[model samples]
Target: MLSLWDSWPLPLETAPPSSCSPPRSSCSARQRSCSCAHSVRPIVPPPATPRASPQYVHNSLGAHAVITNIDVTLRDGGYRNSFNFSPEYALAHARSSVASGFDWVEIGYRKGSSRPELTDGLTAHCDDEYIAAMAREVGPEHIGIMVHPGNLGEHDLDEAWSAGARLLRICFSPSDPRRSLECAQRAVEIGYVVCINVTRISTVAPKRLRRIINAVSGLGVTALYLADSNGSLLPDEVHALVESLISGHELAVGMHAHNHLGLALVNTIRAVDAGATWVDSAVLGMGKGAGNLVAEQWLAYLSQRRAGSDRFDLGSVLELSTRLGESVVEAAPRLDVTDMLLGYFDLSIEHSPRLAEIPDRHAQVRAAGLLAGADS
Candidate 1:
């Protein structure tokens, strides 16, 4: 699958100028020809009036809350099973996700490699073929996939579209604004509903983020995702980041929160309050490292805020969550106060291996001191 990454080329060509010239008119016996005859004539087409911007139509749900999108495949589910999932497990999750009224259920990653087997005959990752087959098995109307920039080439994009992927969550490193723009442009050109993810945004400068947002906005991508990969951002920080990104960009904004600080749900809500139209969550908060925003918590929050709304069926979602948790038993890494404090200070896990190696109360103090020393 990695070899396929080389197949997709960036489309960046402009239409060539017209080459045909208008025929010259000859003056009859009595009149002299105009001296300006040799000058280039401007092509006159009808003026095009600008179209109105698309207004977001709220569902029956009140303005205070909205339905959330779910990612069901091993990428999000991997936190529970160590990146291992059976095909039957994938199918069951898909069926449950659709029955629960999720806007979309991201099926899997379109990657080249694969693990031998996860629980119940499922693989740790999925490719285009498996995704397409599963889409057929579960029905394609609600299936989705997540793609990393430069992971899949143009052919993979074509295959994904052909395999019935209705939405794509495209992820990119925050430091590379040019690469993010290029990825968004390519996804748009290939006719995919692209959600550009700026991963590890907490480490980025506000001005650099603003520039990246503007660049993505100009690419005509469907949405921009503010991903806190390190799980370190506070609710206030999340709100401020969302507001900053939205103030400068015209595209719809979304949030993907990690649960390192156990504040994913609140941060997600804060993001919505700050003008984000899309909110991403996972069942049982099963995702990378400390996990993601909990689907049940977000749904319950929305239910409480917007009672008597048709936007979501919270009861069904809870049922699905219960079944999935029971089926997958792998323990996710614990995120303690030290991890939270490190995140709050913008320190990565790589900073202090000793902290991870040490146990008891001293680890936290040493981790904090190590982080402070590095900053100094």
Candidate 2:
């Protein structure tokens, strides 16, 4: 089969501007040009308005052949509580996830090459000993870990595998994913299932992102994940991106959504509708900023529509959420002004902590807008 990139050039190119500014509604038109130095057209046309109801793919048996559900509670939830979930709590969470039929559990990040002086808690580091213990508790086959290119130490990938991680997700900004691609290549060569996560999907121009995805599709990865790092994307946008990315490729696609806009669930469903195979969630929507798609809620929604959904025992997930709420999380996830601003402008979660420090609400909003311009 031909790779998706085979049909297109590796570099991104923009069409000549016919007008400095096109009408707002028709802005999605490919040849309707803009004079902005940063303007780059989407490789795929914008999808039509999405329906209120979700569309799912069915199996040959005519039943919803469920998508893979990867639980990120321990990994992402770490952002909310400083990675303080104890080994015992982590074990319990993993066990419950297994029983609930989650395909994989991202226990945490691999200890990074940088920030050696910083003292983050267990899940942040996911030391060999810690991962080994978690693997022992909940079978290594279900364990995965995330790593940023900056954080992937020379020995991290091998060590993670030795400690029993079966899958590895390498996350990097879409602006420059070369280093992430390199790390993912190394992990794949080392006998691990690898996924390359292009973070902040909304910030990058579609043509640029398509090139990045095209580059990634050749690296023998298990999947290419679209990370809504800032939670700025709408369901229709998700549908367009996922649909375009998977158009002629045999590679599996996944979605890692942040719920800053209260749209993660809808966005995720849209991605699946457009051909994504894997989707991420946490028990109580626990994570950084406004948190992620709620695992319990997603399973509940799936059970209502997908066949053989009984394997995903919604009660187990709900029980896990309740248990984690009492013992692990400091507070439930909620959207705040800062989180909303982050999503609105397609800024990153790193900006959230600083945005929260501003004493005045108006100042915060103003600062967010300025930051957006600076980033753009």
Candidate 3:
């Protein structure tokens, strides 16, 4: 099957002008009609909107997902951009997100390369000097980096801390909760606000979930997150999970929902109302597959509940979205049948076997579910 681009490329071609185009300054006189000029969508400058420090956010926004998702946008958002964000882009967005009243801005991944060629750019590698410079530019109080299990050892955590990051969020598969928790423990000892994001939350069994929760009960991390990795959950399910986490462990609970079922925003709100203090989202809903919740939408919702239109300068985020919509290569998030199917059946299609043989995504998920059912 053809990829989104290979199958359909016209609109996406227009969406990434700067990345795809030749330099306009060097264009010849006859190049006035160059495809670059035709394809590039002009960004509208945001009006001078007033900004106010939000109340209930404390002096500095603490380690709450509700307040800080700049990191989600920059770090997770890289999936759609091929982790190809420019340093200037990262710096600009960080400044905007911080000024707009965000507590933490996740800069990028501190990942070890499995395939050297795949890791590229400031967003992907998140070099020490590079992110340190970003923290210096935006103030390091809330700058965070995400590390995978086995990606970094104790020594690497020290280096990550010295590079001006105050927060370290570690996410790993639910199948390997012990390894992921170990990384979070080391990060906490290294003196960073650590959040352990457990992927595939919706599918973990009661016994398995209990073991993981028990393991996390005294880890000393800042927060524990249940990532609805395939977006395969309902609002009630989210509430129940949040309640279960609170009852089973001492960790401050958080939720990370994907847009696969078009429920990320609602699930986040439900989780928050159910006593979750943290949540995660991506800018313009940019992330892998169906993408994460939209950061602009999340902040706007927070601002609305509090009575301050300028609380976080949400307009700036919208401006950023418009700017990114004109530059990022990925198409915007939409309801795809297959994605919805994955959510409905509580499976991650991306990890399903025999995917190549299944031409349609919905069918791939169906097959995966059937196989899972048979195995059980």
Among these predicted structures, which one has the highest lDDT? 2
User: Tell me, what's the RMSD of every candidate?
Assistant: 19.6, 11.1, 16.6
Over 31-127, each residue of candidate 3 has an lDDT whose tens digit, in order, gives 1111011111222223433334544432112332333343487777776667887777778878777765667788888863333357666777777
In the predicted model 2, the residue pairs found to clash are none
Candidate 1 lDDT (Cα, whole model)? 0.60
Please state the error at residue 349 of candidate 1 in Å. 5.0
Which candidate achieves the best TM-score against the true structure? Answer: 2
Relative to the true structure, candidate 1 has a C-alpha RMSD (angstroms) of 19.6
lDDT of 1 by residue, 13-90 (tens): 211211221222242211101011112222222232222222233322234433346554356656446556667777
Better of 1 and 3 by lDDT: 3
CA lDDT, every model vs. true structure = 0.60, 0.73, 0.65
Candidate 2 lDDT tens digits, 241-328: 6766775555788999999989989888888877788899998899878999999888888888665555577788888989988996
On the 0 to 100 scale, the lDDT of residue 91 in model 1 is 74
Show where candidate 3 strays beyond 4 Å: 1-70, 112-119, 173-178, 307-310, 349-368, 371-376
Q: lDDT ranking from best to worst?
A: 2, 3, 1
